[model samples]
Target: MKPSDLDPVVDALEAELRPYRDSHHTYRRLPSGGRDRREILDEMRELASREEAKWRAGYSSGAVYHGSADHIEFLNEVYAVNSQSNPLHPELWPSAVKYEAEVVAMTATMLGGGEEGVPTVCGTVTSGGTESILLAMRTYRDRARAERGVAEPEIVVPVSAHAAFDKAAHYFGMRLVPVPVGADWRADVAAAEDAVTKQTVALVASAPGFPHGVIDPVEELSELARRKGIGCHVDGCLGGFVLPWAERLGYPVPPFDFRLPGVTSMSADTHKFGYAAKGSSVVLYRSSELRRYQYYKTATWMGGLYYSPTFAGSRPGAISAEAWAAMLAFGEEGYTIATKALLETAAVIRAGIERIPELRVLGDPLWVIAFASEEIDVYAVMDQMSARGWNLNGLQHPPAAHICVTLRHAQPGVAQRFVADLEASVADVRHMPGSQGVMAPIYGMTGAVKTRGTVEELLARYGDLQFKA
Candidate 1:
């Protein structure tokens, strides 16, 4: 009925989120004078050491893709050299331009950009995947309005597409026509075909979408868009860097990039599989004309004439430097080898989940694997896994849990440990029926509640709690 009614769950969440609140000093206000740099560094290192162990030991899902110590040190050095640089002021930081340009060019080439017969692909690096998707959607919206004289624009997307598309639709005043996925967990092409309308500006596809880690029917969906004379956007934020390598390693990766004539735009995260730092992603278009719509320029301002690309006028150039360095460091061979190991590790995990009688792997996934149970609460199983120090992603719609395999999982015994712990967690959940865990009841409540406004209030209260000093 109210957020207070869920006090027990909220309390547990607070304890987990605010572990350092009581142990560490809360910086409610700045001191009159700055503290010693060494003392500040010591405090920061203490926090970093505590948090780093979780992902370093392969306990997290998709957080640290390439967490090798040497690689991190390299990126840190690169970041340090360019820490003062901003891409917004290219005249002052020409190196930033070079870094960003190389990063985009490398990513585009990897995603079928410069191949013969394909259109010239161009793009800009952004803060992250959300911004990339936002830019692409805005590009489509503006392009449609300018070329087709369409005032109201729409996007036909599978329900499994990333929530960023929904966010873009909400932010840009466009409509998202939802289509259902088939039993294979791929987008239903027929449903998408039917969902398209005269006002539809684009169709959305995913190369291994987030929830179930299954690639959508991109060829069919893109062909449909081609026939309808609309743009098709393939969301590869999670899979872009990994999929090409996986394909070269002989995995069954589908065509889902610029090679598809109808796939006019794409968003890929350098932070995810490209092994860049946390703040970089690339949003690409088939032509410079389409990408120009994502830019902003105005000469009427009080200040000097201003023009900017992507959402932010000023962004850290160090991040782009890190991305460029990471790409060059890995190269094609390094990525192929890494992807092979990742997929192999994922295969082991997927096979282990299949062995567990209570659980079933949701879809045909390569690395990011989701599993669900028809016998018991998957959230309870997830909580049990949490008890064993495993951090996985919880999924709704059909009540599933996932562990996105990173390079950390390819370590010596991580995959084996995952399967063994998962089996033990399922057994624990089965033995203690109705022993609802902290997250299980919360998810149950969220799913059962018809009034979403109550859920939004609960989420807002949770957010407020996060800002508590």
Candidate 2:
């Protein structure tokens, strides 16, 4: 659609969502006087109540991974105790240091590190998966510069890899060579090998890609990088916490961690499968020597001395505390049992998708199930599903939707409800004969715009609505 046509659509969306922005309260700045504590808490509770039902009822995908009442209460107490703690001030709060160190160490061992045969993996706790990836990419860029004397560094990445890699490339002033995946959505070994030039500093693979939920050819990709004497990072942000337990549960999970001789670094989200609260992730390296490049230390600065392991200078120790508590709260057995239930639930959902004649799953995925429709517009199906209160993930390139099965979906009758709703959605969408669904124009604007700046303008305008009172 042209700008004139898009204005109405954007306007309607903005108007409809405006209530969410300024429903009960609108504060551009602090009030003249402090409000009553009881009134503030009640109003905050009222606002939060409007958005809690859908996620709590398992109508969403991947946002709230673990949403049990007991778990939330426990984590809340943990947060309350150490709310003021900061890892930057380790001298003041030594407990934060202990928690951060143990979180990293425990996560390292989880990903086939610190074993007898495996090299000792060492890493620091990052804010989230994006930070971990950025840290790893920067580490590789610096190492290649210092050791190999390569001025212009580059990273060979599969097209299916996370966008964080692209962001890392952009932020670190490196080139990202995108290699297309094969039919099964695994990275082509030959293509990856061919992409590796002298300037290639590192190669990346995803363990169970976010789009298709299929693990890349990490074993081969890492080996290829090894032969080239370059770093190979496994972006396991989505699957690291689940794959180990899946393998232990007798499911076939490929080797995509430090156990592989060529694998140099990995990033895993504690918030996702570790059942920890948000803002916690682990970035692992094969050894401390390699991780040394990721650190930033300055003694000649005017602010006395400064050192930081990750991007942020002063990190929230409370998040690290939550990660530690979650990990200890759920040990190997806990994960194994949860994975068994989660995978079984996913099996049911996957079978349901297979049974629908109009839809075909992209690949054989264990938990994160993505599917497309040849007969109907998949985005229209997404719109219909959204009408039914399903918050699924929509993707381009192939144009599909996926539901990342979580513990919330393992709740009573949630899987059955999803299947029934999905089948109904397909039936509803199958009758539409010709034109694209209501959302076609929006996606068309994304793909059809000649200049990327036009889309950015629309996005910036839309973002402006998010704060309107």
Candidate 3:
């Protein structure tokens, strides 16, 4: 359905998204006179406190990766200390450079940099996973244009790859050729091989893709890229930090990093599983020469000679500092311990979902688990879960929902509680098949509508509503 056709639905959603409109003041304009500092602080605290319980109690998926109070307080203290510092002026705050360089080096080492058969994996810190992927794609596009004389570059991505690749293609003016996935939810290497053409500049793989949380065949895909003489970028934004420790703790993690000969670059998010605050990610390249393409320098500009790495010019050095502090605070031992708990909890949740006869898991995932019900509308089940305060990621094509297990979900009894609630949600869906909820009908309408532009318009309208005071 068109967005205008769903005005009532959007109105209902706006109420849920912006519930504080009734109780709190809407500030379309700044006050003529400044309010009391204490009053402002009290209002902010009240808003935060109201939303804290659901995530803290593991009712959400992937949003609050590490919500421990002490950890949060420590990060907040670190951010406050370096709040005014910006990486752009390195002379003023050389500590920002130190933090970012060390953050890159530490992340590189974790992802098999400076190891056997791998070139010096160097990279810059990006705002987040999307920025990281964008930079990587832009780097390949520029390099292909400069060296290979490829005027029109293309990227071969798995159907299950993150949408950031599509965003990268859109932003950087590159063609994205999508290949299908197999029954196991991993990328189809044969189809990827068939999709590669002379214009193809790079191939994309994912370490535990977001939808089904299954790693693509990086070994084979990267090998194909090597044979085809193209770059292979592994989207490890979701699983990079956790997988190394998971492999160390004896899990079945495939080789998806610089260890593979064909792997040219990678994107890993410190914010996701590294227990760092949001807004920081690392994009690594096989060598410095390839990474140099990602930099922007202008000596003939009206302003003084300047060079900026990554997309943003004056980035939050505080975020890099927080990422560095988070890594140091949670040393290898701490991360391993945390990954152990997360994977164990995920295993329990997976097994619980499997035991339910009505539903079946999409893949053999280690942490992020996706499940679908064959007997009932999975979206309705999602709404039922939402009614019980659970927030899950809804997927299309197969109509599934996933709960990305985080440190919060590893808390005592959270896994069991999730399983019980899930079973109850499935039962509710069975009892009332005709009853519809807010999100289910939206998903249903979006799927039924064949015109993609109409759905795009619907999403645009929702985005517009978010800014409606």
Whose lDDT is greatest here?
3
TM-score of 1: 0.97
C-alpha lDDT of residue 367 in model 3: 90
Model 2 C-alpha lDDT per residue in residues 142-250, reported as the tens digit of each score: 9999999999999999998889999999999999999998888788899999999999999999998888899998899999999999999998888989999999999
What Cα-based lDDT does every candidate model obtain? 0.90, 0.89, 0.91
Against the true structure, candidate 3 reaches a TM-score of 0.98
Arranged by lDDT, best first? 3, 1, 2
Instruction: List candidate 3 segments past 4 Å from native.
Output: 1-3, 115-119, 444-450
- Which has the higher lDDT value, candidate number 1 or candidate number 3? 3
List the pairs of residues colliding in candidate 3. Answer: none
- TM-scores for the candidates: 0.97, 0.96, 0.98
Question: Number of clashing pairs, model 3?
Answer: 0
Model 3 Cα lDDT, one tens digit per residue, 137-236: 9999999999999998999999999999999999888999999999999999999999999999999999989999999999999999999999999999
> What is candidate 3's CA lDDT for residue 417?
94
Worst 10 residues of 1 by lDDT: 441-450
Q: What lDDT is obtained when candidate 2 is compared to the true structure?
A: 0.89
Query: Once model 3 is optimally superposed onto the true structure by TM-score, how far is the C-alpha of residue 298 displaced, in angstroms?
Result: 0.3
lDDT of 1 by residue, 120-211 (tens): 89899999999999999988999999999889999998999999999999999999999999888999999999999989999999998998
